[model samples]
Target: MGQRMKPFIILFLNLLLCQSILAPPPPVDYGDSELSLKDVEQLLELYDYEDGLTIDEPQVEIGTLSPIRHKAAIPEPEHTNIFSAEHELPPQKPLPRLPLPPDALGPQTQRGLPTCLLCTCLITTVYCDDLKLEYVPPLPKNTTHFYGRYNKIKRINKNDFANLNKLKKIDVTASQIAEVDEDAFRELPHLEELVIRENQLRQLPELPSTMTLIDASDNKLGRTAIKNEAFKDMDNLQYLYLADNKLDHIPVPLPHSLRALHLQNNNIQEMHEDTFCNSKDMSYIRKGLEDIRLDGNPINLSKTPNAYMCLLRLPTGRLI
Candidate 1:
């Protein structure tokens, strides 16, 4: 009986030891602490001595954000308009009128033959016809206008019209006048018009500053240079006729006041860019000038690239 009781007591002691080892510890209350999957798996493995533990798969969902909405929180970029930029201002008013001299209406003199009879005489006009004089006549004192056509006058002398301060017009057209002296019309300050057409002149003489018109067509000017200090100051000059001449290169730096320039039937081959640079002021006058006749001249428009036809417009005749 004693041996059987000893076996039962040993079995009971083994069951009590197994229960003490398998019991879990008291749960600790850690406030607001996130537990990782690895930590939870470690805790379950530490207590799973009799049964194995398995974990489920974790679920995750993702969303995308817009880049435009992120930029809207920041300040917008600066903007500007590109159309309102300019460098110069427009012209405001018109130019003033040119002022004439106080003594612009004075009388003029003539210098030539004394025997030349005055065929006809008006208030300010004089006509001498069929005069076979070899030279210009010494005009009467205070003679403002003179007409000496159909005569055989050859050359013009010095101080010819010295005292003719009011000489506004002179007609020597259709005469046999050949040569003109250097000081032909020196002191005629108010002389405006000169008619020397259909003559045998080889070149032009020194003209005056107040000459507004020059009718020098059908002359014999061959290879002549129209150079004189008097031409530089002719601000009132408008008409210039160099037709039927033998000019090869047209004169450069034309007067700014010239409204009509005729170079027809000349032997001009080429023209420079500065040829019409000085005539830019004629556009302010009436009609603003039109016509540039290069018909008779031998010019290459391709070689002369900068030529502007607007600078050759004239008031009286075409720009030939």
Candidate 2:
């Protein structure tokens, strides 16, 4: 080898070693949760260099391809792009029309008339309240309840509720009823409630054996208004409200099933020994008579000690 060329070869080898040491390392790939520029700067600041050599933050290329991210598969929506033309939603379907209800009564009947309001509740209840009628409206065959309050009904004929076996409730409040035929309510096999409060009725109709409640308060049910053995057939009678009446005495032999009896504001002055309790049965205890209101009556309640012997609670009346 020529002696002059030896210096040039040594210089060339030294330049190659310097170039290798100064070259930058390859960029690291980060996944989906890649750090931002600030995160990288903080990481660089926290790093303790063994060689004590300071490193400048690497300038990331704007258009470089990011690292491939691995994640769980997600389900696509039904209408992902609702407004997009190709992925647009289909036209909405029109709702089906509902059929009209069956008109049980023919067009000639009194249904939908101005005299009564048909209640769509159980059993097509008929409300004849405030109608100012003199007689009961001809009800449908399947009426469960009849409300004829604030009317001018003077009498209840036998044909009023002739074949209404399904009739359960009859409310003729404040209707100025003067008479009820002996057979007006005798045939209602399922009759439950009879409300004739605030009326001019002198006597109540003969009720069926199926009566559960009877509210004849504020009426003219004088001493003989209630029939002889008025409640003898009502074995299921629970509540009897004859308050605000001219009843000089309680209807005798109240059924054993009576729970509440409201005879307040009456003209009752005394009670027989067997009216509520029997003088014969001392061992009997009338526990079902939990509530009995006679507070506004003319009778002093202390005088009727023997009458209330079988009651669970004494009737409320003027004690003094």
Candidate 3:
């Protein structure tokens, strides 16, 4: 093997000598102490070493390439554009108000509105108080409790509550009502409470038999204003307040169901023994008549010491 390698080594030396002769001179700066770039390249060429392997360059198919494109621009909305100062929507007209239908009754309001528009009407209650009204407004058919307090009403017309059969209570307190027709509340079959206090009434109109409470206090009612038998037929009369008035004597023949009778601050100076208790019937005991106010009257309770004999409690007045 050494003999065969001797000839190849000699051939390599000869090729290197021939290359050194054929190549141009190297740069003068290249030092003889170190190998130069040209010397190394020549040595590699002479050896001709076989490369182990090579990676192939990737090939691209130009025929499958897609063209560049751009999307269409969307138009800007006038109301949504932020770059422009005048981007605003046009003004729209408001809807018109509707008119009332025909067949409406009673007087029109100052603004041509209905009576309910002037007053407030809940389910079955009408509140016409503190409205500065001059007359009673026409109430709804289902009105059960009507309040016309703190108004300027001068009179109570008979037809004010004519066909209102469902009316139960009428409160006209603190008004300027001077006159009430005879039948103002006469036909109201279901009227239970009537409050006409703090008014200018000189006479109380005839009330229905269903009355349970009658408050005519702070008025101008005299002794004759209330009929002697006004409360005789009222079997359900319970509370009667006629205080701060001009009553002269205790109204006689009170109903058996009378529980509270308030006639304070009146002109009452005398009271019979039977005003509250029956002397003829010694067994009669008014157990239900427990509250009676005669405090502010001119009557001397000592004059009729036996007046309240059958009462559950003594009358509240000046006893001495």
Residue-level lDDT of model 3, residues 1-320, one tens digit each, is 54454445445445545555789545423345654545545544565534411112222347755765877898886675564567666688888977755423334555466766677767788788898778888777778999999999989999889899999999999989999999999999899999999999999899999999999999999978998788989999999999999999888889989999999999999998888889998888999888899999888898887888898799999888
Local accuracy of candidate 2 as per-residue lDDT tens digits, 158-267: 98877878999998988988888888988888999999888888877788889999999888888888877889768899999998888888887789999999988878
What pairs collide in candidate 3?
none
* C-alpha lDDT score of every prediction, in listed order: 0.62, 0.76, 0.82
Better of 1 and 2 by TM-score: 2
TM, every model: 0.55, 0.64, 0.67
RMSD of 3: 12.1
Best by lDDT: 3
Instruction: Give the clash count for each candidate.
Output: 13, 0, 0
Candidate 2 segments whose C-alpha is farther than 4 A from its true place: 1-103, 106-123
lDDT tens digits by residue: candidate 1, 1-320: 54454444334335433444687423323358754435545654655523231433222347787566444466678786554457445767888988855323322323322322334556666677666655555555567788888888776666666677778888888778787777777567778899988888887777777888887877877765566343567777778777777777665555667767777777877777546543454343333335345557666545654455344342222243
**When superposed on Cα atoms, how far off is each prediction in RMSD?**
24.7, 14.7, 12.1
User: 1 or 3, which is superior by lDDT?
Assistant: 3
Candidate achieving higher TM-score, 1 or 3: 3
Q: What's the distance in Å from true for residue 231, model 3?
A: 0.7
